[model samples]
Target: VASKSNLSLVGGNFTLQDATLSASSGQINLVSVASKGEIIPERGELGVQTPNISNFTKLGHIEMINSRAETTGSPSGGISIRGDQFWMDNSSIHADNLGDTDGKYIDIQTNESIQIQGKYFGVISNSFGKGDAGHIFINTPYLKIDQGTIDTSTKGEGNGGNIDIKATKIDVIEGGIIASDSYSTGNGGDINITATESLSVTDKRIFLTPEQADFTSTIGSASLDKGNGGRTTINTGQLIMDGAAISSNSHVSGDAGEILINADSIDMINGGTMTATVMSQSSGQGGSVTLNVKEKIYITGFRPGLSFTTTDVFENLQSAIVLITFGTGNAGNVNLLAKELVVDNNASIATATTGLGDAGNLTIEVDNLYVNNGGFISNSSGGIIGGKIFPGFGPAGTLKITANNEIVVSGQGAFSASGLLTNTLVSAPGGNIEIQTNKLTLADGGTISADSLGTGDAGTLDIKANTINLTDGGNITTSSAYAAGGNIAVTTSGLLFLRDGQITTSVGTGVGKGGDITIDNPIFIVMDGGKIKAQADAGHGGNINVKSNQFISSPDSLISASSKLGIDGQVRIDSPDMDMAGFLVILPGGFVEASMQNCNTRDGSSFKVSPRQRTVPFENKN
Candidate 1:
């Protein structure tokens, strides 16, 4: 590397294609005013330590055409420019595999404007255990880069640098890529951009087209990398990129910084994801963002969690939100008052911790909300959706799910929350709403469950396991009074119904003698297989408490003279020869099952029965 020639020039428009520029074997410098030239070495090498060139002052249009750089041999560099309006076209530049030689691929220290068009400037640092650096610094406030295949690549675990512009506007369009590059930021500017103009993307691809690139070492392989964000402010006027990427920056070791964006209009037609992120040491936040988006906002990627936060808190009452666990969690408290919010099952929006605060309070005031192929809005079961506060405070947050499409809520993996329905159809042809558990209570409609269960306590609890369970884990609570029309509640340790389900109301612990087993309309209370056992009882050891479970027991306190068992429907206790009334006794609807297995009584009050056996008000037996 010491036995090398150093070619030096002053200024001129130069073209270098198919040439080998070696900083480890040769050194070439250009210090000219107006030298229009070319360095297309068909089979030769040009060595130059660009930063080593002493040209504090120079006025020239130096152009670097298509070429390859091999500078990973010593503490030398490939290309360094401090000129006016320097340009590098359809070319490639990089250095790798020579150990820590303090080798840099390209250094642009120019204080004037610069443009990288139709060029593929690549870099790979620390290849084969070697370190590397690269850049195209626009020290001045003037730099324009639009169009090209800039595959800023890094191989092994080392990252190579390229494009370091602190300029005004950056327009990216056509076939431009920041592909095959990695980044680091323990110190320097991984990708520093402080533009006062616009930064927009049109029809472009930033991160490489999903062609997998392998790492060298099992741990630290890649040498170079793609672009990064050095606390950038992408202005709407400064950037008009159809496609581009803010690749990984590894040097910082810490999380990446925030990026402020001000775009007038954007339309993400297809492919490419808008991956905007921020790193909080303990709890970091991003700058304020506002986009007058006209087209669809396609948020895709593994890390598609975009967020904006500040220490500023909104105060009204007692509690305050100090930290937001997830970015999309704000969506539950934040109102999305758009004209339309359609969630295609094909398009999923997920959150880690606090997915959504409360669909209730997070007013999604849209003209329409369509969930084609099953779209869902959920929240953490532990997350709070505070109730409405009148004089003191506390109001129930609400989730208004209006849909022209079907709103079916019945799955093993269901979220914990309440919903208010405007116009809901439950049944075939209209749309079905199935509830596997009675944990739900609709304000108006929406939850018009048409399940097979005749009992509504569960509003639908259709579990058929060897044993049922409602342990410390899962909950089934109703905060406010939905309505006092004709809703019922059932809590039987035994199966409520083997044929249907239970839509019980009473909750907490020992709340009601049992949910108001109301007989509003013509209802059927068939004790065919199971019995309705309530913690409430008049006497005789019936633990059926009337009021308990924390809150006030429902006003099941009937005023008029109605049967405790309003049986307009059939009460066929068809436990034939088993003498069912011995076990299935009702305050209302009287006893209507068979007398006894081997005997009959005139009083019809007391009767004996065998163990584990009962009678059913079998069909045609009433």
Candidate 2:
């Protein structure tokens, strides 16, 4: 089982315990060398005598047990180990290529430490037929794997190989698996990890083996049918995960890969999961998850099994750290570039779609963005069951958040773009929630939503801030039922504050209509029980614009445009300075206007103000 062999063993210390080394069908080399000292000069000495090379404390330590090293068939050539220190507990290293060729390559170099522990340790390069599958290079300063398995697999049509690791320090505990798998049509492989200082994936407590009790620690890739899924790159300075999981998946029609992470600091606690998926009988598409952290990123949540005197508050929650995607094509993008981003307790960053494509796009570039307790950043799409004779649509995706300085959403945190309701069909719209911030804060029951129920339409909600704060029961919404209803734009340069917060656009019983609500501020304040709304039940109702220099409202605050069966909307206030003692309303054809005037006082004296108008008409129910 050898072809073109090269074996060298000149040692001072080299050990192989239960050995079985086969260089099957290839160019083989099994080498171990550490011995140098040949100098005898005393007869030609005269100002030239140099001979001293002796430093051996059992030089170049390497130990292998229950061993098996293999390269079996076709263009094969692999197996290399050069060491200062390397220990394999229950070893099995294979470079397998049986049918279509190409498979065999493994280079491991160690200067200080590398330890592979038990449970039948394996390092494999596999391919069933049609070529491809090989390459696994590791360079280490310190690397440890407790329950090991490093694999590259392919079932038939080839392709699947490439696992490069360079370490300063790396640890994979528990059931440890670093994998690349492609089952049928091939293609799936590529995992590069470079750790300059620290990288850890944990789980593994005291080995009480109940099948290792839910052992985690995994770095993966899998493509099942038409095959096409790879790419998982991590460049770390510090990355820590507790229950560990990093995945890339595609189940049927392929396409689902890409996960790039560059870290200076990243911490994912207990139920850690970072995934990119395209399943539900995939049609392709659904990948891309990028995280570039220069300073900090912490996604927390972890409760082993509820203790500390727990009385089962839903089993004491906390076990979340997820960046997810699910699909039928489309449902994959999540890019977070952070300086400081913290997502607490029920952590989540999601992109979802149930079937017909669309639903992916969540970008967060942070200087400082914190989402508290019930955290969530979502983009959703899925609904349409009965009804739709010829309606084909796919919309629901978009959430862009940029915080250059500060953005905080407290407690029941949520930022969503949703479309999932299908009674009379025509479903497909709901996406768009853009936020640009310098300072924006939403307290307590924080929520930002864009929703469309069926007949398509309901999206826009844009916020640009210099300073904007919504207190207590914070809420910002865009709603629709049989269509149209979505548009709420607020641009603030200095101050806009809403106390018991609420900003809405709504429509319910069919025929569409009910959207507009715009506020541009220099200084606008609504007190105690703040509210700004545009509502309609059967149709038309929208329009409430306020441009402020100074506009303050207090008695219980309220500015509304309402309709019960049809038309009624429009409430405009352009302020120079106004203190509305409380409510402003419009009921039928709408119209509640405010314009105050006369001011010239720096000694010329002319101060007068009085302007408030209203118009209303009922009965318009068609």
Candidate 3:
């Protein structure tokens, strides 16, 4: 199998199968032959050497089945051809090494009457070793990839490119599967189609998600992009990819080989999806991307998410386009932004395997966005999408952003409990927010609404395991239609302070314990420009209790606690102006036998008319 010098010659007619033509470190060529004559070289190995190249015209009737040819050593190729008229069936060329002493590139320069089609995969290395001139092109003829897959991992020690067709017409059929760029980075160069060629890639899916490769150092994983599928540079020529799918995983690449589409006019159409991108770090001084469609641009399936994670410091965008047509074959007007973008709504991008490559710094600022159906957006890497999900938290890694005219949120577990989405609100000048460790207070203009579903104040609207403090200047309101304010739940085992604003709770019956409106810290609740109104008329006793360190309040303010209440610690009844309406009912045996001097006007009709009260905490003995 070491045919390092197998140069087979095919002419007028020939047939060879199950034979291994191992042209290792050698050349395989075809001399000038007449048209209509054929040559068949089928199956087995061909050029498994250093630099296996095929030069000249008409290497006709070639059938490659489960066969392979690759560059051996550091200066070779699997099968380098400059021939015409081929029917390469299920063959592959995995160009692993390149640009050594033998050759730094693999070039296929030909011009003739031929038909190139069939299954082709692997590389046309553009970087790695020989970072230049490692390309593939069938000069001028009708070339077709009936049903095949062509990809590359053009990484360390790789050659030049995947395919470069400077022909009249080209058609690509993806065999109903995807042409993926799944590695971390370093997918061979781009696919460039020059000339007035007609191109088409049949309906197929593709992806370029992050790879789980272990590149200990960033350089070890040095790659510009997954794969620049293809970009066209037309100079008064028509370029079309009717049905095709192009996707990329990582964002380590840029404008496919600078597909300089400097055309006089172009007609682009796509019924499929096209999403090719380069990683952020690799885009050299990245600039804005815009795909300009001068002539008719047609688009069919509008895919879901499309945006390369590029932070180009350039103004405007460097356009990328995928025009489409309707079922009538007529041009379907495409409303584009100087640049054209097409998304196959049918395509679904996969999640990441590692934490590092969770999301792309991709941002889309659209003047208009429409949702055909109810859609959702979620994340796993626990990333932040907005410019800065959280302020001052930078190194948190990849972020995702979604900005639309309208948004809808439904589903129980759609939004995770761990994820807290705080509106990017800027406080008005001189406006303030206050927190009272003692109790809860709401200002006149402040508002607090519940984003929960149940009727039980889910938890404490304001929870201070210890104590809370509130100075005030903002209206605070907890309006829960189904749930109550569970407002100011004090499991703190300390004091609760209520200074201002109105306290309103709307909840049904529940066996859960809510905040006890009793003055406990020095155990005193004080109120000035506020009111406490509680109603337990539905067999649910909700008492409103306020303790004051130094009882002082406005006379017009209403402090009403109409349910059963008790004070075990201390009570400072110094508010002579503010008349407290409501009875203080202590629980059965809830308080230790005690009586104070001038112990208020205890009504005989109250829950408790005795002079006994509790002055100790749950832990203290009587």
| Candidate 2: tens digits of C-alpha lDDT, residues 108-208 | 76668878887647778878778887777788889888888788877879888889989999998876778887888988789899999988987634333
Per-candidate clashes, comma-separated = 118, 0, 77
1-622, model 1: which lDDT tens digit per residue?
A: 3424544455455656666666563444544354344433222122333433332334566666776555545443454445666665665444443445444445454546666666335333333334544433335456544455333333333344444445555544443333333343222223344456554443322232223211100001111122232333333432332222332222212222333343432322222222222221212221112223222233211111111111111111111111122222221132233334444322222211222211112233333343322223331112231242111011112333332222222212122212211111111011111122222222211222211111111221112111122221212222111111112323322222111222222322222222233211111222222222221222111111211111111232111211133312212222224344788756685766665555645765777887876777668845
Error (Å) of candidate 3 at residue 378 is 18
Off by over 4 Å in 3: 1-8, 13-16, 35-71, 77-84, 93-95, 98-133, 150-152, 157-159, 175-187, 204-243, 247-271, 276-289, 302-622
- TM-scores across all candidates? 0.38, 0.44, 0.40
Q: Residue 292 deviation, candidate 1, in Å?
A: 14
Q: What C-alpha lDDT values do all the predictions have?
A: 0.31, 0.71, 0.32
Q: Which 10 successive residues of model 1 have the least lDDT summed?
A: 214-223
Tens digits of per-residue lDDT, candidate 3, 270-348, equal 3333332223333321111223444333332331122122121111111223111101111111122312222212211
* Candidate 1, superposed: residue stretches over 4 Å from native: 1-6, 25-28, 35-58, 76-78, 95-97, 109-113, 117-136, 139-163, 179-189, 204-272, 276-622
RMSD values for the candidates in order, in angstroms, are 21.8, 20.4, 24.0
